[model samples]
Target: MELQFLGSGDAFGSGGRFNTCFYVRDARGAFLIDCGASSMIAIRKFGIDPNTIRAVLITHLHGDHFGGLPFFILDAQLVSRRTAPLIIAGPPGLRDRLTTAMETFFPGSTRVERRFVSEIRELEPRCTHDVEGIAVTPFVVKHPCGAPPFALRLTVDGKTLCYSGDTEWVDGLRDAATGADLFIAETYFFDKQVRFHLDYATLARHLPELGVKRVVLTHMNPGMLARVAETGCEAAEDGMVLTV
Candidate 1:
């Protein structure tokens, strides 16, 4: 399996990095972990064909997490002229949130007739679901984003990948990363303990307990980015790719 960091910045675009988006591909299919507000721009900048993506797994409804769906869908309809079906899996009320976001961005966009089909699957917390042949398990995390935030564990082609999507030090993270080939976690700060975000120091202290084979930290602020070398884990940067 191949994992690509489309964007690895925090909500503020710290260090001029783009927002959070991870592209995962394997023999089964290709999918995006999170489509942040800058995701479409990053996809184009990185020379990725949007039509090749089969599904997008969203962790929460935050703008920096799942805000680019409208642009992506419109691009698929107008630019790519794509006819392949796209699945968007997220927490409950996904359809409503997406519609609201679309309308907020472009008036009447959600009602427009489209060439491709966009399917929204509302994922129940702690339930494993099949998304375009990939098995995905979402565990509810500590972030409060108007809905149940999740840390996702995905299994595709016999490989497992976990993502700790913008959460603090929660026990659910262990469940999300346990026995995974790669764990992409959000280390937003170096050592400062902020609410609803992870710190590198806290993660480092508990890394052994997580039991993941490899750890890559993403969604970093400027302070965390500067101190990444000291964290003893790979720091994810935009356009970086990893094969697992």
Candidate 2:
């Protein structure tokens, strides 16, 4: 399995990084972890063929997390002329949120016939669902984004990958990351106790207990980005790729 960081920046685009988006492709298929608002541009900038993506797994409804679906769909329809179905799996109300976002961004977009199919799959907390060929399980987390936020745990082939979407300290995270091959955590701060987000300092302290083989810290602000190197954890940068 292979994992690539297409975009690894916070909502504010600190350090000029793109919004959060990760591309994971194995022999089974290719999918995305989070399609942030700027995901389309990021994908294009990285010279990726967006039509190759089969599905997108979202952790929450926050704009920075799943807001780019509208543009991604449009690209697949108008630009790439995709014929395969695209799966969009996320928390409850994902269908509504996606429709609202689509209409809000490009008025009347939801009513258009894109010549392709987009499947919306709403995921319940702790339930493992098969998306395409990937197994996705969502864990309830602390962030409140007008709906339940989740920390996603994905398994493909025999490799497990976990991501602490955007949340503060939540015990469920430890469970999601347990036995994972790679755990991509959102550490927005370095040491400060910020609400609804994790910090590198606190997350580092718990790393030993998570029992994960590798950890990549992501979704950082300017302060966290500056101090990331000193933390000694592998930090995510736009366009970085890893083999799992």
Candidate 3:
């Protein structure tokens, strides 16, 4: 499978990067890890066809993490005229959050007639579910975004990928990332400890416990971006692609 960083910036668009979105595609099909507000723009910029995406697995309900659903769904219906079913899995209240977001973005948008079916699955913490072909296990994290945020473990095509989502140091991540092919972590800061955000130093201290094959840092602020070279770990950038 091939994973691409469609958008790698944090909520504030630090380093002039786009919001947090990742795209994965292989012989089976394609899916998205996170679809932030700028994901539509990033997808278009990367010349990706929205119709090919089978599912979107969200990490949390933050605008920079899940806000692009409104545009993605509307575009699929009005522009792509898609007929394939789309699976969206996330934390509890994801369905209601997307509905409110859609309506807030474009009034009465959810009630529109569409040729495709959009399925919403509210994932439970520690329990795994098969969404289309990807296996997803959500672990509750510390970010308080109306609904609970999650650190995710996803396995597909014999490759496992874990994401820290957006949180401080949490032991659950060790379980989520242990023996994974890739761990996409959120390094919001370089070394300064911040509430509800991970720092590079904190992640590094626990890296050995994770037992991850590879680590790619994402959702970084300016502080983290500036010191990425200091971390020596792979740092995600817009449009960077990795094959797993």
Worst 10 residues of 3 by lDDT: 168-177
Q: After superposition, how far is residue 165 of candidate 3 from its true place, in Å?
A: 0.6
What TM-score does structure 1 among the candidates reach? 0.98
Candidates' C-alpha lDDT: 0.92, 0.92, 0.93
Q: Write the per-residue lDDT of candidate 1 for residues 1-244, one digit (tens) a residue.
A: 9999999998999989888999988896689999999999999999999998999999999999999899999899889999999999999878899999999899999888988888999998787899999899999899988989999999998989999998998889888888999999899999999899999899988888877899999998888888889877888989999999
lDDT of 3: 0.93
In candidate 2, which residue pairs get closer than 3 Å at backbone N, Cα or C atoms, i.e. clash?
none
- The alpha-carbon deviation from the true structure for residue 139 of candidate 2, after best TM-score superposition, in angstroms, is 0.2
Which structure is stronger by lDDT: 1 or 3?
3
Model 3, residue 176: displacement in angstroms? Answer: 0.7
Q: Lowest summed lDDT over 10 consecutive residues: which window, candidate 2?
A: 109-118
Best by lDDT: 3
Error of 3 at 140 (Å): 0.7
Candidate 2 lDDT by residue in tens digits, 105-219: 8999888887778899999888899999998999999998988899999999799999999999889998899889999999999999978999988898889898999999999
